[model samples]
Target: MIEVEVEAGAWTAALPDAEAVAARAAKAALGTVEGDVVVLLSDDAAVRALNARFRDKDRPTNVLSFPAPENAFPHLGDIVLAHGVCAEEAQVQGKTLADHLSHLVVHGVLHLLGRDHEDDAEAEEMEAEERDILAGLGVADPYAAEREGRA
Candidate 1:
């Protein structure tokens, strides 16, 4: 199961269907993975605080994923998204907020499922997976611009 909690007002104001968008994205990412995920729709301040507390980074990022311990089994983890950062990135990437949000949710859920982009090979594999998943949802290739040297 996937749960979406909108903790920021901007999310709804910008996309009234934010929760549905996130839930659908999360479900798409789950595929063969089994677990429950909690998605938090928050602001930069909250995400910055979380980044500082957990990653020692005092900056707000678009998304963050905290995986559950092994013993937790079916309870996968939590995925948090910062509305401000996501909105800014979407605008810069020339994508809709919903598309970007879906991409980030998939990215975060992949992390929770033990997928990582720590190395080039890993990044390529992960990007491929993301592309396949996003395509299924009718979202364009998010890395197209980057591949074309436009990002």
Candidate 2:
């Protein structure tokens, strides 16, 4: 199950079908994984607070993932998205807000699935997976822009 909670009005205004988009992206990421995921659509303030309190980062990011404990079955984790940062990033990256949002959801879900990009090898592997997942969603390769120096 994927539950989407909209905590910010901007998300709705920016993407009225945000919840459906999130669900589709998350499901594409999960594939055969079995569990429940909660998605929080919030503002920069909420995300910044969470980032500071949990990650020790004082700034807001596009998305953050919190995985469930090892023994937590039927409950995978939570994915939070900051509308302001996401919108800004989408604009900067020359992508529609929906596409960028889907990509972030896929990235966050991968984190919940134990994928990390702390090293070159790991980052490459994760990016490959993201590209595959996003491609399945009809979203172009997100890193392609960076590779071509467009972003």
* True-structure RMSD for candidate 1: 1.3
lDDT of each: 0.97, 0.96
Reference-based TM-score of each model: 0.97, 0.97
Predict model 1's lDDT versus the native.
0.97
Off by over 4 Å in 2: none
Residue 125's lDDT in candidate 1: 98
As for candidate 1, its clashing pairs are none
- lDDT of predicted model 2: 0.96
| Candidate 1 lDDT, 40-128, residue by residue in tens | 99999999999999999999999999999989978899999999999999999899999999999999999999999999999999999
RMSD to the true structure for each prediction, in A, is 1.3, 1.5
In terms of lDDT, the best-performing candidate is 1
lDDT of candidate 2 over 5-82, digit per residue (tens):
999999999999999999999999999999999999999999999999999999999999999997897899999999
